[model samples]
Target: MQVFVFDWTAYSENVDKFRENGKMIRLGKKHFNAKTAVDTYKNHAEAWQELERYGFDGVAINEHHGTPFGLGNSPNLMAAALSQLTERIKILVYANLLPIHEPLRLAEEIAMLDCMTGGRFICGVGRGAPREYKIFNVPMSESRGRFNEAFEVMRRAWTEDSFSFDGEFYKFDDVSIWPRPVQEPYPPIWVPLTGSKESIEWAAAHDAAITPGVFPGPMREDTIRYFAECQARYGRKVDPNKISIMVDCYVADSKEQAVDEYGSHLMYLFNTLLRYDQVWQEDVKKKGYYSSTAFEHLRNGAKGTLAEDDTVFNEWSMDTVRAAAENMPLGTADEIVERIIAECDDAGANNVLLVCNRGDIPHDMYLNQIRRIGEEVLPRLQAHNVTFVPHAQFEQAAS
Candidate 1:
């Protein structure tokens, strides 16, 4: 099993100062503090470097814009820095938003990172959050088409000597990129999904690995099952190594201790930061970002937000935190290991992405958590191997 830590790289200091009313205000230059932003990047980079020393296989970063939720507006830039800062740990952009980017340039940049890191880069692509669409002034309805065309352009740019693309969203002629990717054909492409059937099928068709995103256990299993079926339709077999699960984890002396320390940050994540520049799911659906059945299995007959139900957000409290912690991998190292392994086993996933930092926990505390995960959780997880894909097995049995 490969273990990766996902960092949000949020603006860490004085988080409460950014809030207006009860909600987080859209952060702009006024909210920006140069020292705070610098420290945030420096601390996260230091933490990422520590992952290499602590024996983590990779460190994952993501992109967001115009919010304090994640300062990683250009995850590619972060990955480039990581290539220089760390020696061995894979730097996963986990994803670059394809729809909003010029694909040829993205291709060249990723190739540069791949060459810089000597093929230790994983290219994760996605259509991005609804808020990002708004920031870029892109039509949410055209996200799928743009994402597909962008990926095709990048793919061609990476593999072909000279390629031309004339697509609805992008047009290029006689494009041959310098600094070709170190990996043959291209670097591994991974997609982080929110249980969208269309996204799953698209990933399967492209033979990209997928992380089922953060969701409850049942929904995650359904995603894997559907993905396996999709892979089979494309004449491919399910590979455990190609499936990854993202889980919010914390390691402490006991479950109670873990919850007591990490619960507030978790709550803040859900109640405040995540809601910054929030776009409601109903609006997203109306905009055609999601098909009618995209999230049918997970929806509870209520219009939810992109990641969770509106009720969950509205009803968030300490009780909600404790309840959520029950399912999360939070507890002693042994307990966390057990839960993570069980989740991976049940979902037929061999890779795990641990989200241990969020909601602007103190820098030292964040480092402590990473150190503990490295010393305690990492070894156990690294030792465990997932050998079979349950989804594929189930499909065979049904057939």
Candidate 2:
């Protein structure tokens, strides 16, 4: 099993000041303190360096724009810095928004990072969040078209000697990149799934790895099953090594102690930061950002309000957090190990991305959790191996 830490890189200072009427003021740049931002990045960089010392296999970062939710607006830049900062740990850009980027430029940037890291970079791409589309002034309806074309352009740029592409959103003539990727064809491509069937099919068609986004148990299982089915359609077998699960975790003396120490930070993430762009989801849905049946499998018999209303936001509370933690790996080290093993066993996923820092957790507290998990929980996870994928087996048996 491969264990990676997913750092949110949230801006923690004066969080309340950036909110108005219970909603985050997206234009609150006046409140931004230069020193605070600089120190935050410095602290996070130091923490990432410590991951190497703590025995973690890799560190994952992501991209977001014009929001305090994540400070990594340019994850590629951070990945470049990580290349020089650490020697052994893999750097995963848990993704770049494909639709908004110039495909060839991104291809070159990723290639450079791959070479800089000695082929340790994992190239993750996504259609991106609705807010990002708005940030880049891209029409939501054109997202899939742009993403498809951009990905092809990048793929061709990496593999072909000199290629010309004439697509709906991108065009090039006899272009060749200077530094090809160190990885044979290209660095591994991984997509973060948000229950979109289209995204799953696209990933499967490309034979790219996937990390089923954080969701409830049943939903996550359904996602894996659906992804397995899609893989089979492309005549590929499910590979557990390519399937990863993301989980928010905290470790302490007991479940109570863990909650006491980490509950507030977790709540701040859910109750505040996560909801900053909640309203945009509906607008994006109207503009065709999400498929009409995006989360259909997860809906079960309930009304399809998953896309219509942000129910997750309405239901978040400290009590809900504590109850959810029961099923999560947020307890003592022994309990965390047991729960994480069970989770991997249930999903048949071999890679786990643990998120210990969210909601602007204090730097010292974040480092402490990382050290604790690295010392007590990581070794056990690394030793345990998952041999089969249940979803793939079910799909094969049905076939």
Model 2 CA lDDT for position 68: 74
Q: Give the per-residue lDDT of model 1 (tens digit) for 205-286.
A: 9999998756545566667777778888878888889988888899899999998998888877877787766887657767
RMSD list, candidates in order = 2.0, 1.9
Record all residue pairs in model 2 with backbone atoms less than 3 Å apart, i.e. clashing.
none
Report the C-alpha lDDT of model 2 over 128-210, residue by residue, as the tens digit: 87778877899998999999999999999999999999998899999999799999899999998777778878888999998
| Candidate 1: residue 319 Cα off by (Å) | 2.0
Runs with alpha carbons beyond 4 Å of true place in candidate 2: 21-23, 293-311
Model 2 worst lDDT window (10 residues):
299-308
- Relative to the true structure, candidate 1 reaches a TM of 0.95
TM-score of each: 0.95, 0.95
